[model samples]
Target chain A: MIDLFLFGIFPYIALVILIGGSIWRYATKQFTFSSLSSQFLEGRLLFWGSVPWHYGIIVILIGHLIGIFIPSGVMAFNRIPLRLYILEGTALALGLLLMVGLVLLLVRRSTSPRIRRVTSTMDIVLLVALLLQVLSGIGTAVFYRWGSAWFPQTATPYLWSLATFSPKVEYVTSLPLLMQVHTANSFVLLAIFPFTRMVHMLSIPISYLWRPSQIVVWYRRQAR
Target chain B: MDVRAQVATVFHLDKCIGCHTCSIACKNLWTSREGAEYMWLNNVETKPGTGYPTQWEDQTKYQGGWEVKGKSLKLRLGRRLGVLSNLFFNPNLPIMDDYYEPWTYTYEHLFNAPPSSEQPTARPISKVTGKFMDIEAGPNWDDDLGGSPVYARNDPNLADLSDAERAALFRLEQLVFFYIPRICNHCLNPGCLAACPSAAIYKRAEDGIVLVNQDKCRGWRFCVSGCPYKKVYYNWMAGKSEKCILCYPRMETGQAPACFHSCVGRIRYLGVLLYDAERIEEVAKSPETEMVAAQRSLILDPKDPTVIAAARMNGINDEWIGAAKKSPVYRFVKEWALALPLHAEFRTLPTLFYVPPLLPIAASSKRGKYDLTDGEFFSSLEDSRIPIRYMARLFSCGNEEIIKTAIKKLWAVRTYMRAASVGDISDQRATSAMSELGCTPEEAREIARLTSLPRWSDRFVIPPYQREDVIQQLTSPIGHKAQVGFGSNVPVRRGP
Candidate 1:
């Protein structure tokens, strides 16, 4: 019953909150949408913490996304022992890098009095949750030994079931405690995403690459 | 010709008395918020002293404005991709220490203190930390060259001066400094507009006032570092960058900006300047020595039939054209050529101009008696306490001749006025001084009148914003009337 509720109904609840809350927040209080950067208050440690954290987490999330989208491709690549080792090794290094970056960020938040003054409750919650998620992910990779191989078989099917509006608890029911924690905590992150600075991830500003450097806004149309 | 009407300014530095009434008025009207205590939208700083952000003119440390590479221009901060990569952590952004930590006295301590032998004191507290703190510095800490040895000695403009000249600047008998009031330049090529990753900062097409869209700004902070003058400020509480909006709401109603309205010395002149937008980049790319002249050439003469026709074709109304005809800025910047843009080498093509100050004549003591006459009448300019080279560095981008001409013209006006009113100097001597700069007696009288005795209307020739026409095009004017007002409808707050 717990597995059915945790793995089946809870994902839908998290998704509803994630989508609805983000839209509502965006429509009602659009001004609140920002990274709320504390770099101006304290930049040196922020440079050390923020840069690595973004780079490492972005790559790791992309890897996870790829596993969900093309499980067959991941399985095909994992067929060779050498290729599997290389893939697993790279993932482990990146996960470690993410961990190191998160630790530095946590230290910066706690030690710097200036940053601490501006640190909100949601900021602390998000940072702690991210640290736990990364730790459990590293834990699952270490003990289970071949997450790249097993993730496609188990988590992807379960995620697809959630997406397709069908419950599939058996796929992830028997997973190890660390893997289960990793999966559950990700949903927690999604549920709380709208209320945190993490929403800045959605605002990547890739359009700036093509947009003209100079922007002139006109209240009235000008004749060319 | 891509003609655009810009409401520009000319600040006569000689008339400024270093009063901060403009700063106070601006603060009370706009930036008395929690996050904006440190921000002074308009600040007057004594020259030969480091400015508010402490050596903001030194671009090497801040990496602001733009740089010329071959024929094209790029942000001195970096390219677009570089800005994206550094979005998470901007290395060039100034810390609070650089701009001085804003603070307020604990006024409640006076009322709430327990009975004591000594008088109760309202100790200083940090606005950011909300704790008792030692006050070290402020926005105008170096006002009137207060810390001359430390702040004035470290001025970036003093880089080219010799040791003797530098020493002479600080000597007791030769001390000289002038006040320079600064606001956003609203440049033809604004570096802040170019550096924004979110495309949040923009210049208004009608009036050329640069503004940051609060809803779109995501606190990347590149705008703060990108502006060469360091005018853009990051509101830590709002998580958005803010700058001088040139008081658009007030301007739309045809009133002068608060700073211009409240200027105690009446040194500020506000008027519409019609300029060709097509040549902004070409003029910004001019060599350092030729930058002042290049920028002057950018301003289209409002009286020119071709320019008026182009402006009409471009949809600039008749009122703005008429205002441009009577523009004091046009006379100061183009006709008289007395005012020049500050730091023209920054290459943003700043629209704000300054008529550089003429310092007190350098006098000598002859055996305990004063000898005020230092040879020829205008030759006193050569021996003035403040060197022309320093003023050139501040205004003309290392071109001494531009500063000399401006000072000579101003000296002629002063001489002409003294002959007419005080009768201390002969009219023949004053006319000779005026003739050197090719100034007629009538022109000198006009210059003297405009500089010292002009009325408010003559000082600020504000063009009608015609906001109703703009509102009609965007939405129903009736619907816009319900929403049109000063201050934001939405509360500006920081995100989690």
Candidate 2:
């Protein structure tokens, strides 16, 4: 009963809160909606912490999405001997990089007084959960080397079944404890995304590169 | 010409007495909060000395302002891509040491100390670390120590001065310095405006005052390094950038800025000048030596019929144009040519001008009788204790001729006044002096009146800011009822 609730009911609850809470925050706390950058307080550690963390997570996320989005093509790509070697090597390297970056960030939060003061309970909770998720993920990938080849055949269909509102717990329920913890932790991260500073990810000004150097926003009309 | 009126200021360096009343007033009014304690939105610096933030003029250290690249102007530090990438770690930003660490004394310890013969004293505590610390530096640590070698010798502006000229400035007998009170220049091309990643910093169209919108500023310290003047500051507590708002809340109500209003020397002159906005980048990218002249040339004469027509066509009402005509800043900067902009070489084309100090005449009283140079009427230019070279470096970017011209005109006015009021010298000397400088006797008297005894309203010719016309643009201006300051009952319009 608990497994059914954790995998089925919890996913819907987390998704609803993530989407609805983020929309509410955007409507109400527009001023507070920011990356909450601690670089101004202690920049040196953040350089190591933020850069590697972002790069590693981004590449890792793309690799995961290939199974759900391009399951058949990825299997064909992974079938090749050299391509599979490269894929697994890249994944292991990025996972280790993500761990180091997360450790440095956690150390900075605990050590830097200025940064520590700004950090909240939610921040620490999120960080711990992320640490657990990363650890479990790396463990399963190491212990089960060709998990991607196996995951698409099992987990992708299970995700599709979940998305299509059909019960197919048999696909992912039989996975090892390490994989189950990683999967469950991701749902918790999604549930708390909007309430914490993580919502700032939606507001990145990536469009600044193409815009003009000097921008003058006129709140009132030029014509008097 | 895209003629528009810009409210400008002039600071008479001769009259400033190094009183930091303006700085305190600005601090008390704006930046006295938790993370803002380190910011001095207004400050007075002693010339021939390193300024606050210790040699902010050394662009090599801060990497601020703009550089004239091959055909265009690029930020001295970095641009679009740099702005985005520096989010992880901004290497160029000034740490708290550059600005003094904000500190507060532990008063509670003194109050709660056990009774003893020795008086318990309050000790300084760090605001950031919340612990006892030895206080080392402050906002104006080298306040009056202008002649001290440690602070004064390292002034970055002294780079252009010849060795002998620098020696003369430091000589015990020839030691001369003047106060230069600084505020954000609200430049024609503000580096801070360009470097803001969120486009949070902007120059207001009504007045040319540059401001940072706290709501939008992500505490990206690019604006801090972006300003050559180093005026923008980050508030670590709230994670936002703050700067001198030019007292816009006050100006919107037809009042002078806090620093200008509180100037003890009455050295500040606030007024408007009609200028061509389209030529801002062209003027900003001019050769460093020619920047002052190029910038001054951008200011169109308000009295010119074509200029007046263009300004009116550009939507400046006649009343604002009238204020620009009577503006004392224009009279000093453009008409009599007494004041010059500070650090035009930065190529920001700063709006604030400084009237270079005239070193008091060299005269000796031997055995009670004063034997001044009677025929010369006044001390010659070479007789000046403060080198013209130093003044030129500060104002004209090594152009001594410009400083000489301003000093000559001021000297002519002084001699001309003495001849008119209490003449020990003949009227012919004053007439010849005025004629040599191409200034009429009437012009000299006008300069004397404005400089010596200006009426308060005359000094601050605040153009009528019609904030009243723009309330309807707000969504539900009266939505908060009496709580909203800008709640208006009328309609407004919009255009870009």
lDDT of 2 by residue, B212-319 (tens): 765566566688888989899877665667788787667666778888899888989999988998898999888877877888899999999999999887778888
Clash-forming residue pairs, model 2: none
How does the DockQ of candidate 2 come out?
0.37
lDDT of 1 by residue, A60-166 (tens): 98999999999999999999999999999898888888888898989988988778888899988999999999999888778788999889999999899888989
Tell me the deviation in Å of residue A191 in model 1: 1.2
| TM-score (C-alpha, index-matched) for candidate 1 | 0.96
- State which docking tier applies to candidate 1: medium
Looking at chain B only, the TM-scores across the models are: 0.95, 0.91
User: Each prediction's Cα RMSD?
Assistant: 2.8, 4.9
Runs in model 1 lying further than 4 Å from the true structure: A221-224, B365-379, B472-488
Q: How many steric overlaps are in each model, in order?
A: 0, 0
Overall local distance difference test of candidate 2: 0.80
Predicted complexes: DockQ each: 0.69, 0.37
